[model samples]
Target: MKLKLNQLDILLEVAAQGSIGKAAKALNLTQPAISKTIQEMEAEIGLPILQRSSRGVTLNEYGQVLLRHARDIDRSLHQAREEIDHLLGKAMRQLRVGFTSAASYGPFTNTMIEFQARYPGVKLVAMEGRPHQILDALQNQRLDIAVLTAGTSIVQSGMYYEPLYALSNTIIAGDQHPITHTTSLKSLMNYPWLDWDEPGEHSILAQVFRRYNLPQPQNIVHCSSPWVMARMMEQADMVSMWTSVRLRFPGYNVNLRPLALREVLPATSIGVLCPNIGRLSTAGNTFLEMLRINARDWLQQSDAAEMVARV
Candidate 1:
């Protein structure tokens, strides 16, 4: 290709920072040198890639196209380095994995435990975040794999989502809550509710109330931290949505119990999202296999009603 990797690097930096001088400083190159690289690239391409302005430079259509491939090339080059190092016995295999908050309730940690016991040399880095955040990390080459629910989720190009299992969620409350005794959508809404603070997630609780033609609850508490929510559930009359497998994870107290309501949340797909199976590193592929195997067992053992209590 006419555009060298270093030139593409400069272009990407300039696009991100929006200033040639900033890009030059970041790349440890002189301002004129950065300009010369762009000039050379434009000379070869026979068109301008950036729109020069007094404030800063931005990528034009041509520049955006080049940047898309540039990022891909950069990630592929990184994978190639890791592959070469592993083959040379210079570095141990590493797997970077991420999961959404809902997926944390699944058997991800158990699978990781078994995988680590089996492959002592493979390194694992795990992260938990929202679905969009996980997908962003995967697309930015920060994470090798991500497991999340496929419900009104973002779908990016060049990324593949493999459905692993069907997942469900439900509302949970402390045993002290009055709604626990007399469970009704109206009665459940009477008390303050706690839920995830993720804006991208579908408001299943709100949707359920709306489906019943009831006014939306006014007393709602949104929490981003599951630990904080659990604490609140133990201390106060708070209700929140939780996956059936949530009981498998730690930090939950005996005070919490699932509310048997006639209305249940919609089901979603629990699956693995990654770049490409063929491009996955040795450890990455192995971890993906572990997820698949564990997901099958989890789905088979999980009772449908326990996860999603539909009337």
Candidate 2:
């Protein structure tokens, strides 16, 4: 409690940026001032806070532990500020949610049901958009929270990302389709693909498609719904991709065969995103907690298979 907040902030900035100079620039302080503060703080803690090398600075283990404590300290400070703001009647009571979809990975209904049941008094506004579009809305102050998925996706400016769960991709073909054995990237293209009809654009899947020098799999038909794709695959000589999670859902009606690929597919990591700069509403924090806890519980209930799509 007696520690200086300014010093703690400086250390966090440095730890986060991994460069004292950059942290100093971020906090609008000179390099010498930043270095001096770090030295003094390390003395106070009686240990070195960082390791220096050609790769840049990284927090020492002891410093990392203290950083966690620092974050809790700062969070308490923020709560105090929020209480003061509420006393002035300036705090918001509503939450605006935005998210993108992988219809195949639909657990939002369960998540929404639990959220509304727990926070009956909070106003909820939900919007659906593509991944980039949802991020844009969050940056422009149109949304309070989002759930999105990307591979090795970086959190953009003004938001914090808490990873939720990973969805693995798998390739499926109709029961009657000829190839069910481990199909090489070349061999699979011998048959037409049952495809989702999105315009040709640079995406993780598209990138993989290009890497293999395969033309967009010639499709006999196109649809967006995985369920529709699933049904179409029942009798067609086509193959499609799905999250292993969706394909294995109990009593799922799809009758498709999994194709063998050479390497394990890369997973799509999903996350809950929220504003990093402003005060947190009680509702926003609660929703984030619910998302993480629920996703953890869901993972416990299933045995997942590795899928075919890799980024």
Q: Give the CA lDDT, 0 to 100, for residue 298 in model 2.
A: 62
- The residue pairs in collision within model 1 are none
Candidate 1's C-alpha runs over 4 A off are 1-92, 155-158, 198-215, 251-253, 302-311
Query: Which digits, one per residue and each the tens of the lDDT, describe model 1 over residues 67-91?
Result: 8999999899999998786784522
| TM-scores of the models, in the order given | 0.62, 0.60
**Residue-wise C-alpha lDDT for candidate 2, range 1-311, written one tens digit per residue:** 25699988987898889998899899999999988987888888788888999877888998898799889988999999888868634333677888655522445546777878876766788886656667778878898888876434336444687766677766778788888677765677667665443545414555457766666655435554666677777867777765665565543444776788874555667777777725566677777777767666666653422431323
Best by TM-score: 1
lDDT of candidate 1 vs native?
0.75
